[model samples]
Target chain A: MTDASNYSLLLDEIAAELDIPPSKYAQAVQRYTSVGEWLCGDDNSDCMDDPDVYPQGSFRLGTIVRPLKDGKESDYDIDLVFEIKKEKYATTSKEIKERVGTRLNNHGTYRRLLKPEGRRCWTLEYSETDDVGFHLDILPAIPKTPRTGAIHITHRSGNGTYEWSTSNPKGYAQWFEAKNITAFITLEKTQKNMLFESNRELFSSVDDVPNQLIKTPLQRTIQILKRHRDQRFANHPSHSSKPISMIITTLAAQLYSNETTTFEALKNIVFKLDAHANLQQHDFILEKSLADQKLILRTPDDKWIIPNPVAPEENFADRWHENNHERAKMFFQWVKWVREDLVDILAKRSVAQLTESIEPFFGERAVKMASSRLPFLTAPGIITLIPTNTPHIEITNPPKPWSK
Target chain B: MKEIVERHFQELVSEFKYLSLVHEEPEIFSIQGNIEFTSSYSEEIIHDSYNITIFIPSDYPNSPPCAQETGGRIHPSFHTHNEGTLCLASNIETVRIFDENRTLMHFVKALLIPYLHQHSYYEKYGKMPFGELSHGAKGIVEYYGEYFNTSNPIITLLLLKIIAEDNYRGHSICPCGSGKKIRICHGEKLLALKKLKPNSFFVYEYAECVFDGLESDSIPTELKSNYIYKKISNKNVWQHRSTTHSPTK
Candidate 1:
């Protein structure tokens, strides 16, 4: 077929490789549910009255990617909100944090799996021996009054002092869902039908298949962007200042306009975000549009604001103005990188060229996976023509030497 | 310092299994190793390996380490300095890359591995993989000329002067004779280069460029009045007098 189609197919394959496998997804759900039941189970004396446990973050959003730690593929971090029905002001942050810790400590299995207390959540590490291992970060939270689906989770500063931090994962998810509605509506039936057909033994009908398993182009695009961000900052000193998954997801969701393909969605999102980041270089129309929407705001004093859609007070870019806007600078640099690595490279290059171009950013395994699946689409001869050691063109901005 | 060096060495050795620590002193740490790479795409096996020694100074993360070809496979013609250290990249480039990923593993993977691969590719093909640059001062001028997107060395030097002084006036006249403002011309590039390092670094680079121009007799007549030329001329005078007064001669 054409090179554009090949690029799209290659992206789809790479994103698929990065995605959480169905078996792992099921295991995550089962494990988190069991942990939830154990917390509110009758055996525990200090169990909460009405404890609600559910997956949040990427897991709930269906944008999970196999995380890389120390440059190696590590466990999936499944964040679960172990929220309770208690009044927010009735208890202290320390008490809620301790209550969850104590309950998990009460269980022999959970206590063994439980890591040292995190700043906010209690981590349960599932070893790789358990098959496609994952970690569940159970956030102990109490409901925030007058704000629907918002909860005040505990935060522990470096000085070992605890404070209440407000988050609305549920509300954020709803906002994301609203943005993804058009694409979701278009793809839901077919995805559920496919799911039911594949797992005939588990589901009685297509309707019985859970909605979480259905992924739209928007979800897949977020997954790819997150993986790119992770790889870009893998070993860099700017790792701490790298663009966070929340901002990536939020921007992707906002820019996503029911693109039918993952490649289209990702390209548009990166292009638009790059334009938004470097507004002065772009056209006045885009600047006016951004100003009208106020999605990404730049104040007169050079402060940046990327507000949380659900909680307007919680700026995703709160730290962007700090350290001479290092976070903001790095975010734009990353966008430039994504633009180069993903969009520019994939424009009209051959399958082999595209694979080689993306290998450094997406890693060899994903590239190999994409390459292996390419012969069916393109001629085998084209695939065999992959160069062993192609020379790079002379770089435009070459580095200066010491003596010379 | 020793502990930090040891830790970085350990990290480097962990990822690169063939590399091992050879020598360790308070100020210097060395590792001798062989790196191997085989292409994943080719069914017909192609493997390249190189034996090398890496010398990391105590003040690393600020300064870059040096690598030498212990196997003598790579000739000096292939970008090795007269002292036999592999010219993997420009010092400032190394600092920039290392700053981005301040890990020994990244140093080896990003810089050393590519250098070796380029050398090996050159050996097999009888040409450099990525085109080569002139050895000493001329290469630096060529690099900056490309960096500022100006073929004229004079414009490049002016941009370097701006960077060295850290005085970027966006609304000032463009140095490229474009008759536009600096911001409309090359202001963004200047700002980017400025952010890469401090003004002091660019000051040294500017002096080096001037010295290079003088040595090659390539300095245009207009630059005779430039401040960099005056600074170098003063230093040259002091050096000439000091050498003339040496009694050992």
Candidate 2:
């Protein structure tokens, strides 16, 4: 049997290679920082006073992987939340969205790259020389309270009014970060030192470290899963309601127990995720009078909830109830698929065989890149017998048809 | 062999947090533990349960241990017999299911737990959780029928009888209702069974159990005489064995 620890190391190496490089991540931070400055600049102060801008989604969680579209590596969606405060909570949702869009449009460089208004976010697409690029999805919002982490973001409803939608992206990120805090920080330091040693000009000190560059076991597990999901659903664009990154991150975090290796964490998380996806037969009810008692992955109040760890009121699966549980089904299917694939890949003894098996799920390009960077990627080491006075190479058995 | 059993015992302890090994010896293993059998609507803890005498036979795994409950409180009707021996599983069935990897832990979890669960369920619901398999010889026949994918008990008995005699006629019609020659249908299965229980004595022992009610002191010489066989009995042979020998209700 293959040591589970070894397979875990292999997965970590692969995830590290697939992750966005520190240089590219640093560039993203710089761009977002500039946008944050503009959002709070002297000219835009009237729209919202002292607005804050920060990343959300995989970017904030440090689980960003090279996105795939139709089997081709593509742009990463860097989610940024622009939050503001005002004395009166009277500003219409439309005004808040427009104010942020107008600020981006007013900027000379952003005007060319700014996309037409999305339902919630105003996107800015950045061009790149390689296949990989970036799409900055800047969302405008207001906090639920001055100190609380919850926020209400604006979304254009079908009734033609921008309504406030509850979200807690910061809270979710904090919960994810706390899952493997020590490992993440330790890796962050190691990554920074390595970056400094390699290129002293790029990073002068540890504080200059690219925080997003370090990958923890939990983060790597999520990255591998996200990549698998992207490649698996690449062809089914119309059926593109695959499990979202936040739900996956939340569920994986809930199942993670700070396993020392990425492989172990991924294996455990995949299995646990699949286990939860199974609808508990006992939880189902058949009586008509029990109509008010349906709790299929929901609270007793009948709200479909995979509760935000930091805020109980925020249900990440709120949309699932309305979508005929399509997202739930897709999420469970992906969980089972990932579990089976990981089990099959981890059972392979030969490195070449293991790489071959994982390529279908992680993509050939990513697997190849990971294999090249792996320390033991070379062929199995030769076993040399100790030299004797009269050494002889002896054949144990004649090669037969079956043996060949 | 000792190492294998010890390792499996350790695994059983770890896998089931509630279970613990109270005593261990060269030929006997006594496990005393409790488990929370939680179902949909309710959760109940079955406490102070122990199967004291698990007689590990010399030909273990091939022959499973006959576990007997230690406490006298459990009624004989609850999956156990008058001698307090628990019918955890059919030896033939468990061996076939687990094959070469039939370790003590696998047997305990797969078969022993179900037996215990049945008792606990009976205590709660006043009935067996599922239909109980008939005990002793009749149960063995029923089990083999399922294993052979046959529904008729008479066919099972006759097939074993033929295997016991080692007189499988290729020209004889298959007993599986397949309307095929015996050489093709069920031939492989019969050969496999023969390989497992090579001595004809074991097969005859099963045959004797199946036909024990037929005659008081007959060697059961002939099976070709269908007329004689039909005239011998026209009642529930199992019921006539003894009033004490009742089928699992």
Best by DockQ: 1
- lDDT, candidate 2, equals 0.64
- Model 2, B1-249: lDDT tens digits are 566666767776554433354445666555543332322212343332332345565666566665665433355666565567775555555454445366766555455555665565566678654445565566666666765778776677667666766667877888777899888988878777766665444444454345542223333333333332333234455346324432111
Give the winner by lDDT: 1
Error of 1 at B203 (Å): 64
The TM-scores of all predictions, comma-separated, are 0.58, 0.57
Cα lDDT listed for each candidate: 0.74, 0.64
Those runs of model 2 whose alpha carbons end farther than 4 Å from true positions after fitting are A1-3, A88-90, A158-160, A185-191, A198-201, A280-304, A321-324, A378-404, B1-249
lDDT per residue, candidate 2, A248-308, as tens digits? 8877777777786787788777766555654523385434422332222655654466766
lDDT of 1 by residue, A1-404 (tens): 33445577778778778887666677778899999998877444443877788889988988888888888778989999998778866788998899889889988999999999999999999886655688999999988853579889999999989999899999999999899888888999998998888788777889887788788888888888888888999988989999999998998898888888887788788878887766433233455665676778766777778999888888899889899888988998999998877876542234454577688787788878876877654455324333354322222222322432
Per-residue CA lDDT of model 1 for B137-213, tens digit only, reads: 56776777776778888777777778775678999998888999999899987877787787657766766665554
Off by over 4 Å in 1: A42-47, A128-131, A198-205, A279-286, A378-404, B1-249
DockQ, candidate no. 2: 0.02
